[model samples]
Target: MTDPAKHAVLYRMVMPEHVCPWGLKARHLLRSKGFTVDDHWLETREANDAFKAEHGVKTTPQVFIDGVRVGGYEDLRRHLGLKAPDPQAKTYGPVLAVFAVTALMALAVSHAAFGSALTFRALEWFIGLSMMALAMLKLQNLETFSTMFLNYDLLAKRWIPYGKVYPFAELGAGALMVAGVLTWLSAPVALFIGGVGAISVFKAVYLDKRELKCACVGGSGNVPLGFLSLTENLMMIAMAVWMGVMALQHG
Candidate 1:
């Protein structure tokens, strides 16, 4: 008696010009799941076309378990009780990745420029890098970002143009802060926007009790619009005030 679970047949495209990645993935998946794969490589375009036509399927990398057809790579994943990866799935991973990388870069740059890593300047660099990274995400798709921003932003709700300019303003302030130059421009912009953002987030989440996504990362982000949003605004405010005080004292 042959066990159906132990055997799989994979029909994948493999040619001189190109090899299908999904086909390779299918083979790997089958092997990982303890299936002995009978891999069939269609060596040419004509062979691939003939196989698809004979099987009455549109695409290659088709799988079969115990002589029962299991369709393509996605179908195989379903058969194995694995959810296909969704690119549009809302997650904080993108924002978290950006912040983590930017923080490391900031620390590295700070260490290189200054003799120590633990300085007020390092904090400024972290904040600046974080802001620039966030702005870059927003600027990727301004239309989508603005729509998300207007959902909870007080100023954006009142003035539609504010959403469009927000990313540019953030980028400018962050750049100036990173350079340790143009405190006059950076401080005021950061102060005003950060204050507004903090109040808006507080009102929306704490007062109104509205549960929403944060646009701090991007339009399609899944980061919650509460503590993280508040923290970002507060950080901006602190940076602005610190820079302002330093500027006054240095004069």
Candidate 2:
């Protein structure tokens, strides 16, 4: 048993219909941290409201240590040094999710169009859709994306306006490739940008040994600038070359 001075009091809402998850987490956190928790549950809405009014706080589960209020779950986490300062800290989750969803969509489209799930056409569709999706993320906030891009992009760092135009170029090429039209335009655009992007990413990550977030998905994305970024550029370059060769063969 911990000393009385190390006791934590937690008040959380628990009803037949609703149970506050944060309260449970707070209690667990306190218990894990070797604190003896005096847990109190507010069973009714009126009781919960009254408890909030009494404490001068709006949200549950509130924690108290040594007769001092420690706020809610997030606040408690902060007090315990378990919460990161930035809530939107960098993570590869957004980029991974975008790729996974777009790949599935490409497969579905391929199945519908050519009646085959595993085909070269599916790969083409996947690459095209991935580019468009990534471009869309950048287009969400061009200013932010451009700013982040300028951090490591060699060309963008030199010509500031290139960062602003990059997303549109990617989007245009992706759309054209997906439609199997305007290969003459799409191929050259994809090739040029993809070539530049590959070199920039390689130099920044491998040569200069700079660790930075990728601006591939969006300016605010937490995707790291490394292999995945390189792979994306390589995919674009390969697709452009393939499309150009096919066009020449047919012409």
Best candidate, TM-score-wise?
A: 1
lDDT of 1 by residue, 81-106 (tens): 99987665556676678778878888
lDDT of 2 by residue, 1-251 (tens): 45555799999999999999989989988888889999999999999999999989888889998899999998998998896345557667777887899899999999998898888888888899989999999999999999999989999989999999999999999999999999999999999999999999999999999999899988877788888888878989999999999999999
Q: List the residue pairs that clash in candidate 2.
A: none
Q: CA lDDT of 9 in candidate 1?
A: 92
Off by over 4 Å in 2: 1-60, 63-71, 74-89
> What is the model-wide C-alpha lDDT for candidate 2?
0.91
- Candidate 1 residues lying further than 4 Å off, grouped into runs, are 1-5, 12-21, 40-61, 68-89
Collision count for each candidate, in order: 0, 0
